[model samples]
Target: MFQSIPWLESNSELWLQISIVGLGLGAIVLFAETLHRLTGNSSELARKVVHIGTGNVILVAWWLQIPAWVGISASIIASLIALLSYYIPILPGINSVGRKSLGTFFYAISIGVLVAWFWPLQQFHYAAVGILVMAWGDGLAGLIGQKFGQHPYEVWGMKKSWEGSLTMALVSYAVSCLILLSVQGNVWQTWLVPVAIAIVATALESVSKLGIDNLTVPLGSAALGYYLSQLLPLGS
Candidate 1:
């Protein structure tokens, strides 16, 4: 089965790179959130937009194989500066519209660009699947959960809903499988990988007791998909 997809043999580095990138992004989000709370400021939409947009641009530049430490250092510096600006309260005059939705969109874009850069040239199809799952699946889960979540489930002492989590998992897995099969030409195999990724993503999103879902879901799902693809003999 692996023989059918020769690309995987040469593209192992891509997966590793993506995993590293995802983890890095997650860490940055965690740090930013902590900083925001410490400063007594909500992690508003403007802040998120700057973080996501700048982060994506930096990751894309790195993906172009420009340099290693250059992009990483620049991202770190920029993030630190953004965090500091929150304390200083630089922008008091400008108000933006759809800050939350816009931030989420750019956040999703950052993840997508990272996947695009690190994954094997053709494995982009799989990455795209992961991206869409993170954006749409998580987005719908939040929207529905906020509006209609009545029954709450306490998992690890966190207030989450089985209803919302289940919704996120099902939608994410379905979308992921559809995209993967359609794009990777692997329509016959059991959907174990997609299911596993959905579960991981949902769990992470639900238990984001630390308010880091914006960062974790995308990277976690993508990494899960990448690893599962290896075990499933998918023709990446």
Candidate 2:
């Protein structure tokens, strides 16, 4: 059911889902802000919390079967908010992570893109894969890499550690496999798709410039998984 508009009357769940989505995202930001305050304004950690938390909203959309337009609308709105935060303190703990990067903005855009691509097709699981990949994979990779990454290397003038790259690969594979397995069941495509997506996602994350990885990794992983699954026979 669609949400009712002015001069229109009918049953619609659109506004309900939108309210849930708004509350969900708002809670994430509130939690992140609280963390920032408690931890002496550790923007980086708080930002990661927001990163991981916001990405999980795809799950909510999937479970509720929210309409594509609503999801896309939310994403576009979030992207605008993220972009605006870059110049202002609108998202104090998020954009000002002491880094010159557009990862937050890119992340929001990727969500919108994935929802627009998959929701209408009723293949929202792929959207889940993409968002969770960015959420857990990239989020954990950054955290673990900074904390444990010892051997560092530079890619296109950006420094990264082997530890982080490995984390990204393994996490991407797991997230992909988990979501895909549920959608396609135990099958060859399930294994192969995640493996390929994982490899590509790691490579994308490694060469990320100005946070472009936020855009590339999830889109690439989800698209690759979709195409690869189409090629292989899936189980029921």
lDDT of each: 0.57, 0.87
TM-score result, candidate 1: 0.54
Question: Tens-digit lDDT track for model 2 on 1-236?
Answer: 87657633343466777789899999999999888887886688998999899989899999999888887888888888887787778767777734689898899899999999998888899888888998999999999999999989999998899999999999999999889888778877878788998899999999789999999998998898788767775642
State candidate 2's TM-score: 0.92
* Per-residue accuracy of model 1 over 1-236 as CA lDDT, tens digit each: 43456687566666566556556655655565555656765545324433433344333434444333443444455445444443454442111332222333334344544444444454554455555666567666765675678888786666776677877998888878776666565554437778788888898777664346756776777777777767766443
> In model 1, where is the ten-residue run with the lowest total lDDT?
92-101
Per-model TM-score versus the true fold: 0.54, 0.92
| Best of the candidates, lDDT | 2
